[model samples]
Target: MNTSNMDRCLRAALLGIGLALIGAPAIAQDAPVEDAAAPVTESAAAVEPPPPEVQAPSLEQAYQREFAFLQGQKADLERRLAELQDRMGAEQSELEAEIRALEAEVVEMGGEADRLEDRVFESELAVDTARENTDVLASTFLQADFSLAEAYSPDLGDRAPAAEDVSGLFDAALGVLRDAGSIRVEDGEFFLIDGARVDGRIVEIGGIAAYGVSPRGSGVLAPAGDGGLKLWNEDTAEVAEALAAGRAPDSLPIFIFESTATEVEKKGTKGLFDVIRSGGVIGWIIFYLGLLGLALVVLRVVFLQRASASTSKILDAVSGHVRRGDASAALDVLKRKKGSTSRVVSAAIRNLDRDREHLEDIVSEAILHESSHLNRFGAFIMVIAAVSPLLGLLGTVTGMISTFDVITEFGTGDPKLLSGGISIALVTTELGLIVAIPMLVFGNLLSGWAEGIKDDMEKAALRVINQYYEGRARGVESA
Candidate 1:
């Protein structure tokens, strides 16, 4: 049955049962009550009301109605239960389909995850290799003395270079190679790996050579054994200038070493004495002679300084005494004074009693004698000045001979051996000039001083002799 019919049937059956139960109660109440006292009268009989007929529902009919209603409800319940079961079944099927789809997706996602992991592993290895290669390239640049790269080296330190740093290095290397034959100057530094760090201006000639100079010092940079730089005591001024000027003449030689070997490092700048010593034995002889000449110069200067003072006053006093026929007084004045001039005057005064011509001869003799004393050690100084340069020449000749002898024995294959002779040849000649120039200057100066003093003495003696003649003539006139 349909739900509506079943509901109507159930409602009708309940209504009938309710009506029967209510009617029963009403009919029982309506029935006359039996009285204990009996009193029947003609008036009571006439007023009596008749009882109404009320029927109760049949049991069979009620049972049939209830049964039919129950049947209809059961069918309706069955129909609804069927519908709910069908709905639950459909929902279960859909959930199962969704679960299957999710399962497949999980499996596919797992495979994709594995692939991503593999790719990530390969990427890691590539990164590691790149880092290692970068390290090696940086170390090569330092060891090879690439000065331009040194400017960026300080930032690298002992760490792996970043992508940017690698790219920058590549670009810089290409740029350097483009101008490989040209000279370049850059602000850079020298890292000794474990030693000192020097910051200065660096000069480079393509890839062949590099040098650094600062207020501290200057030296060529050479590849070190420990992947760093070493300072070599080599002159590279031409290269430095070319680098600074950004150009060079082909004839100007750069700092290209003979064999890429590290040059010997000197302690400091060599002095004049050191250069002389490099000339060897001959150098020493020239140096010693120079010292002797210097000593003689000092002594002669002192002697001349003392002897060349003003002597005209002493001469005047002596001449006055000689003119008055007072030879003893002139002698006393000469004894009191000191110098070559005084001695000359004393000698002339002692022979004043001689005739005028004889007096003149004696004075001349005295002045000649004083000249020897004035010229003391003058010849020795001249000899020293002349000998110093000759000794230097002797050193040069000996050095050259030694050089040629080395060539004959060894064929001059090694410049170091050849340099031994060359240094001696050049240095000794330099030392000789160094010695001779000063000695010549001072020697001549001392000689001039000595000659001036001698001339003074001759003048003083002649003045006294002339005065003596004048006084003697006056005496003759008085006679």
Candidate 2:
């Protein structure tokens, strides 16, 4: 039995035992008291005399009776408990069966819900696909309508049908396509290259190309920006005449076009000066500075060339004369030579009889004096190099300012309005770099070369002194 049923049976058994015990105490209390005196009454006293013979129940007898009663109650409770347990068992079986059936139903319902969910998802996907297809169809229809209107007939503007009327639009587009496939000749007045209009037979080979035949001139035709034909500046008169006569020419000369509503102008190449002029005043200043820098470089090159001429040969000849103990001849050779090295060597030769320290000081002084000429224009060239890029940056800042000013005034609607400032910005920067790079490179190189010449001069003067001292020592040794 279940716990609840067992507890109920136990409680019923306890209640039966309690009731038997309580009834035994009540039966003992109801017995007549033997020691108590009977009330005096003639008939009652006679009847009480007979009642005195009645025996009260003994303790053992009373207990035995109570036990017997308890036994009966217990049997009764056991019967009731057995019936309750049987009823409970049947109910439990029924409840378990119902629970199992409910669980099966729940499982079936869950599977159905899953299937419904899948169907819902598939339906949503199909709905989205249909929406996308409709959008594609609408977009394609609108684009086709625009292309037809622009390429074939300007008068067919905005003639798009409703979304449901796709068949009608397709029919119209197909008819226009068929018409555009063949050559058609029409009497029209077209403009010539010189802007003169003349009556002509315009032969159109599809919507792509056209040719004109006229008495004044006959050639291939181009759009004149007014939905009219104009003569192209090409020599295709024979082809135009052949098309006009309905004969296929050996070579087909035609001008293909998309629309005649917009004029097509030929673009010309920009020259160097035109490009420089586009950079405004700053660009021109940079350009002139570049020219001046070039001139300075040339002058510096010439000066350095003259200063370093025949340096090695002069040094060799002077050293040879000094070694032969003829200081006068070496001095004559130095006088004849013309260079910073020569001047330095001559000073050394003149002071050959002096102490070594004095001779060295004299040579250093000569080198320092010649440096004034060797280093000429070097600082200026470097300054120009350093300043050019900064000037370019200045031009760029001004150009950007101008560009922003244009934007502030006109709201940036047209690119052409802003292109001028942008050109100035870019061109000035490019020109600056172009001028500065080579100047910087060549200026450093020239400075290095001048320093090399000075080193050579010092070496030549030192060699002359060394040769003189050696010759004197050799003479002393011979003495």
Please list the Cα RMSD from the true structure of every candidate, rounded to 1 decimal place. 32.6, 7.4
Task: Please report, as a residue range, the 10-residue window in candidate 1 with the lowest summed lDDT.
Answer: 257-266
TM-score of decoy 1: 0.49
lDDT of 2 at 3: 52
**Superposed Cα deviation of residue 393, candidate 2 (Å):** 4.9
Q: Which tens-of-lDDT digit does each residue in 43-136 have in candidate 2? A: 8756755534445455556556665766676778788889999999999999999999999999999999999999999999999998888777
Over 157-229, each residue of candidate 1 has an lDDT whose tens digit, in order, gives: 6766567776766677667677877767888776332357778777766666777666555566765434334
TM-score of model number 2: 0.63
Q: Rate residue 253 of model 2 by lDDT.
A: 61
User: Any runs in candidate 1 off by more than 4 Å, and if so which?
Assistant: 1-176, 179-190, 193-227, 230-267, 471-479
lDDT to native, each model: 0.74, 0.83
Which residue pairs does candidate 2 place in steric collision? none
Q: Candidate 2, overall lDDT? A: 0.83
